[model samples]
Target: MAWVVAGVVCVLYFAGTARPGYLLVRDFVTVPDPVLGAAALGRDGAAPRAVPLDAITAVLDPVVPAALQQRLLLVGSVLLLGAGVGMLVRSRGWPAVVTATVVATWNPYVVERLLLGQAPTLLGVAALPWLVIACRPGPYRSQLARALLAALPAALTPFGSVLAVATLALVTTATSGARRAAAVALPSLILCVPWVVPALAGAPTRSAAQGADAFAARQDSGLGLVGSVLTWGGIWAPGAHLSSRAEVVPMLAALALVLVVAASAILAVRGGGRRAAALVLAWSVPPVLVLALATPVGLSVMEVLQQVPGLALFRDTHRLLGVSVVGGAVLAGLLVARTTRSLSPPAVTAAVALIVSVVVTTVPDGPRRLHAAYTPVAFPSEWADAVSSVPAESRHVLVLPWQAIRPPLPGGRVPFLDPVPRALEPPTVTSRDLVVRRADGPVLVPEGEPEIRLDDPTQARRALDSRQIDVVWWWGVPESEPPPGFVTVHDGSQITVWRRGGDPRSQLPRGILRPSTD
Candidate 1:
């Protein structure tokens, strides 16, 4: 029956991945830099400075095809998950049950990543539990084997390293024996050494700054806790726009069952299963604690605690769903093991039905809507017809703030600039860079707000003219048009293009227009 359940889950996951509706369009369109970093590595060896470079140079390089890479990643995650489940089933009945519970309630971010092609995180998450299981007290040889298996996933990515360390610490406390603890801890520590060099070299500082800013934003905004819980726990509120209440009821019910299981685990700990109870507590508590600490003052800590850690990672908090799922699976397995000792067919059937109900209700709606809201906006698809209408080799073309274009003429290698300047700040750099690098030519300043502010238009114009910018793609007619001698060439759908005549550098501020040799 457990095998059947696992099989069903795998099938559903695969089906979900294949569905067109399941592809998260918005996330793909608004690819964050970290995600881009991974994608760039997967596609090409080097990181790209701009979207055009990424799309043309990185994506088109000799790296593995996108579809193939995605499939491999998906398969790898499932396999790791299955290995964890297998270890749980093979362990003592209580431990098996606890492990299963943790896996079943996996983070929604895992699913989102599957939908978005961010496979490294998924692989890492799936591997953490297996590592824990392998590190449990056992023969020295077996412990070493488990430790190795556990380290494999953690070693693959930076995010995985953090999760792996946290899981290792919990598992060490949960299991008995010095050797087992050392076996697990040592390998993880060793595997994490590489990250230290990068961290010391400056990665951590940048990461910390980005994380702090993101944390501040989350604190100010109420921390998106409710949304994270719904997305991961598969529950939906009555008035929430993303999902139907009916669709969410089952998940809420599953969550209730999980709570019941958690209670049982607590009771079991009191009776004798101290290790199992502690493991469950560790799995559930730290994420919540981290979130609380990150929250800004004023919101009651008590109120914040109730909200969950969904806000910390935004849509990615769906990752916490994994912890809950694993907890539930463990609890279910424990119950089955305990009840089967004396139960008859009818009672067993009833028990199974109850567990199934819990599982069904807890599983969130698949990643379709989540994906739609966040996928990258494809330039070729969104603006192809409009771009096609323009004559090839035309040096200048106006593009809307929302419109996207591919670089080069009819797809040549000419340097293209977005008419409107893109927002180049962190937390979502790829999408911004993509917009900037796909212009028809260098002078095509983007048609909207420049991410950087200059003291005056004279400075802005001077900076542009200095860069040899010959054309301005204004999305909407600016409150004040570009200074005299710039001719408007095209205008439509919130976009206008202007050709420059006299150099504006002379009118610009020396501080702003003078290129720094540095």
Candidate 2:
């Protein structure tokens, strides 16, 4: 049974992730576990928020090939999604199994996110159902196994962790054996300490600075955003929007989608699955409320919430939408569970046909669409040239074009990404870059990498002297010149590398520090 479900998941997802593209999106950039303890930290910015999978990645960092490290998560994603929904309809017939798998796996919420390279968010998506299962009554053979499952999402993504706790809380309040649940949940907190301790210490991260709108649920009307999210297609990028207004078919499909959810919730309660039904309902509703408030009427309320320290963490409604997909799928699973009892040919045929029709409507030409959108890339030879110039033993390195920002994907024009300090593979240099998000950020660490403004070259020079940055690779943007008295060691079409010195510049151009446009 397990193998069959796994096989189906692979076949479905491979159409999206395999060959022509895999890990091709920007999300793969954050897979390096940048927050792992090191002698020098990245001044490039606060590391993407830490979660439990980071610790796992960190442990594997030394031995595993870098490409394989992230690929492991990519592979786990489909398995978890398959296994999670499988858990929800395990006893039901093959129609329930096939229908549940397709309904859960083929959604835009999953594929579009994969194209955007949001591995962690998808990891959370895959783990979400299992988290609920581990917390509620189950057939687990051991107490320790359940407890570990309870903590599983906690380790995957921050939002997933909270959602897990929320589900557990709802289940705990209604169950008779509250003591056992409490005891199980308490130790799971211990397991979360790796991520929890760092977060509680208030170690600065890029996440802390995000304004509410940057993380807002949607740019369109609240109701419209709710519709888009429901139909599996609300995204920050404009092109990704699957607008209902664009056509009549989409409008009817979305409306029908809503009716399906409402009907499934009603059916679950009537079908001796009240607790499960309530769990999905509890999970699904908040995303709409959040999107609504983020829109206008409740803007004032969100304003206050944004100000509260640590509250902005929930600001990203897109992440919430991804997490909510499971609830909707489980509800759909319940509806199918009602019909697939006899495993009759007609029942199986209907279920399979329905799932296929939805997939086609939502994601026409899936593999071809993916191929056009997600062509993979490799690091340019220039990156290799620059890293080689930096002495292997250098204590720290800083990068310029340091906005401490998340920019749109530059259309794959560059081989890798911005700020080599953050994305350098076969990472060699130690970095203590400050994580401040201000656009005109005042130089924080002085010389090395903390948003250095050339106007304050004294402080910049002092910052340079104090930290002694080896091989300052200012590559992504054009600059007028290398700072005074810095020896030019390596200059290339994409970057200018410099080491502190008392003498004049090298044979490279004395002024106008720009890389070749080509």
Candidate 3:
């Protein structure tokens, strides 16, 4: 029966895989800076500042489409979820409860993230509960196989690696004589050794520096740290005020339920059980404390701490959703065991209600569309296609400001320069400008902030000459006036491409025009 339920869930996930492109367009469109950075690293050893836009373009690159990979990821997540359910059904007591908790924690919201190619954090969160279940001192003799199974997911991604280590350390400390925990943790340690090679081979990239800065920035504000926790925990709704009376009711009810179950569990299992409870508290404490110290008062303590340096290593605080659910499951299971022993029908009914309530509250709404705040930036299909239409031999194509390219070009070999806010570099640019002055390639002049400064023809010409830029893609033009010395070749509702001078190709190098088909 348990396997049947797991099978149904897996099928639902698999059935949803057919429209990976549409899914990417709808829900996973927001090209985060980190994802952009990762893509750039995958393309070229160094990432680019102007690569965020280019990365999106690269994902759509005709040569290397991400559709198949996305589908496989969806399939894998479904299988993982089924595996989690199977583990729960086969286990007993706290271990069974832990497995169930992991299933609940791998919620639709988290699954949605996974479906969208953001596997690092999801992988990390998934590893923790799995490790706990695998390392629990039990009668299982397949120690080697269990250890490998526990470590494999964690070792696959950066986020998972951190979470695997943290869980291993915490579980070992909490579980007396759980010496085999070290064996389970060995795989992750072994897997992470290679990242060091990259650090050794080149000068440190801004990733480390930026990561540090991002962490420190959170520490300094404390608001983000707090808000991050609340948001991550799924406790704070997008538009609702935390202090409102409406919010207080749900918060209080959830808290009351959690406390009641926890107390009941402790009372049912005195002695060793009490010790186990203490260990649970201890295991849960550090993350909470780190969150509290990192976040300010009035913030959702759990969410904010997720952004801290050490904590930030684990991207999703909602992963703790597994912890909460697992804790509740353990409490419920213990309560059931105790109540059944006493043969109290009324108590049993109440316990069933409590279990149902926990499940109801925790099952987050299934994956939804990307937030409005991120929609425009998320869907870049039209823009990517437009950019790809540029003739390959054309060296200098000016990209207009409004048409922001996303997912920088694959391999970071192609150069894309946007002229936006001078203070801000494009999210995907390498330390050096490889394409800016290339004799054979066309320089891309991104329209907008910096180009707005080009309102003065002399200044614009000087700006153009300085960067060796020849062509301009102008967007959002009025009929009355347009920039001087440029002939409009293409004009649309919000964009216009311009060729500067009759001999626009004079400065462009031969064979430089290779339109990006991604």
Q: Of the candidates shown, which would achieve the greatest lDDT relative to the real structure? A: 2
- lDDT per residue for candidate 3 within 1-518, as digits (tens), equals 33454455545434544433322321122222112333233232332222232344344445444444434444454445445534543444333333344344333334434433344344445455566666666543564456457766555454455556766655654663445566555544764443433323333222231222222212111224442332223221121112221243334443454454556556744646544674346325433644644344413443344333233333233344434433444444444444545546676556555654544343232222212111222223334433333333343444433233223332221112232111112221112211111123333322112211333335444645554444454434434333454555655554455555554222221221222211
Best model per TM-score:
2
lDDT of 1: 0.42
Question: For model 1, how does the per-residue alpha-carbon lDDT over 1-518 read when each residue is reduced to its tens digit?
Answer: 33444455555556434532111221122211112232232221111112221232224334653334434555567556655654565554433443353345333434444443445556766776676676667676777666766766555555566567667756765675555566566666766544443333321112111222222212101114533442343211111122322354744553465566666566567777666666566446534644544455423432343222212122233344455445545555665666555777677667656655555444355434433332222232323223333333233322323223322222222222332222111111111212211113211222112223232456455545554344545434454555455655555544455555654542321332211110
The superposed Cα distance between candidate 1 and the true structure at residue 167, in angstroms, equals 2.4
User: If scored against the real structure, what TM-score would every candidate get?
Assistant: 0.56, 0.76, 0.53
Worst 10 residues of 1 by lDDT: 423-432
Sort the candidates on lDDT, descending order.
2, 1, 3
Clashing pairs in model 2?
A: 41-431, 42-433, 43-432, 43-433, 43-434, 447-463, 447-464
Better of 1 and 3 by TM-score: 1
lDDT of 2 by residue, 319-415 (tens): 6665556677666666667765566788678865775466445554444444444444444457666666776556555555443323333334212
Off by over 4 Å in 1: 1-4, 16-64, 91-119, 137-145, 173-187, 193-248, 294-321, 367-518
TM-score of 3: 0.53
